[model samples]
Target: MNEHAVDILTELRDLVREFVRERDWEKFHTPKNLAVSLSVEAAELLEPFQWLATGENGELSAAKLDHVRHEAADVFIYLIGLADRLDIDLSSAVREKIAMNRAKYPAEKVRGDARKYTDYD
Candidate 1:
């Protein structure tokens, strides 16, 4: 089966809703708690590279890579859950942010360059 065959965010939202309803977890899934959970999961996702020395490539075994994948999925799941709880349309937000970033880093000046937006054009 194809992993990307479905609308993952919508499926995640439904699953979260069912989970919350089953466990009466809505009260505990407040925005504050969700934000904290998201941050913790994000940190977990970063664990594989956390101790890499500067300019050193971090390497991981297959099991470690699997762990990283799971952690990353957890972070995204929690983020979508939080967005559903708050009635936020995450896709729209991402689109708007991309537009904002394009304005900040216009291709005409930044194309093929690795400089920060504040650097000389």
Candidate 2:
């Protein structure tokens, strides 16, 4: 096992690219297919919390948490793979979105509130 784990998102993207190059999988990795896979993986990640009510503490066993972690990893892996396939820069996009969110929800208005950005005064 590799003790030193590389950046997971970058590793996943590189793995996908290498697989595509080795097996010609790019022909099947269309935007629509990737989008559907992304949604499916996201749904898998949400499955563990499906029964939990809002603001309720759900019972998640260690095994269940492990399963959730795997599902979440799958979701992220597919997302980065899709981004790589589409030539999108995920890091820059995330930074840009965070900047936009900061402008939308200044700390003074949302300091301790859990309200939506639009609901903030």
Candidate 3:
């Protein structure tokens, strides 16, 4: 991540920490609990698009879009919380995963294709 992006993420993470601390919710924010919350929030994030043929690419009503936005934020917050609980660096992990995926799905070989790396000859 760039310096600005890192700063934003740090700010958000700190905000979540303070919110949890203020609520005395840290005890409940265990790695396991946070992981479950994250997964649930991810599923909620998919709710707004559940029946949309075009998914996010199609226009949504303002209310539905707002719902999607809030669900996405919930997922992000839980993800950051889980990272904190696990002492993981989200940016580094994402970057490393991107690098690994680049190798696994090289553009030259995977471009215009929608198959897993294992599916390619």
- RMSD (Cα, Å) of candidate 3? 1.0
Question: Which candidate achieves the best lDDT against the true structure?
Answer: 3
User: What local lDDT does model 2 show for residue 75?
Assistant: 81
TM-score winner between candidates 1 and 2: 1
Evaluate model 1: give its TM-score: 0.80
Instruction: State the lDDT of candidate 2 residue by residue for 1-63, as single tens digits.
Output: 122333655677787778777998788888788889989988887777766664133577676
Please give, for residues 1-121, the per-residue lDDT of candidate 3 as tens digits.
8999999999999999999999999999999999999999999888778778886545687888899889999999999999998999999999999999999999999999999999999
The TM-score of candidate 3 is 0.96
Q: Can you list the residue pairs that collide in candidate 2? A: none
The lDDT of model 2 is 0.77
Clashing pairs in 3: none
1-121 per-residue lDDT for model 1 (tens digits): 2345336656778887897889998889998899999999998877786665641334776777788889988898789888887889777787788999899888987889888888864
Misplaced by over 4 Å in model 1 are: 1-7, 53-58, 112-115, 119-121
Measured with C-alpha atoms, the lDDT of residue 41 in candidate 1 is: 97
lDDT of model 2, residue 86? 80
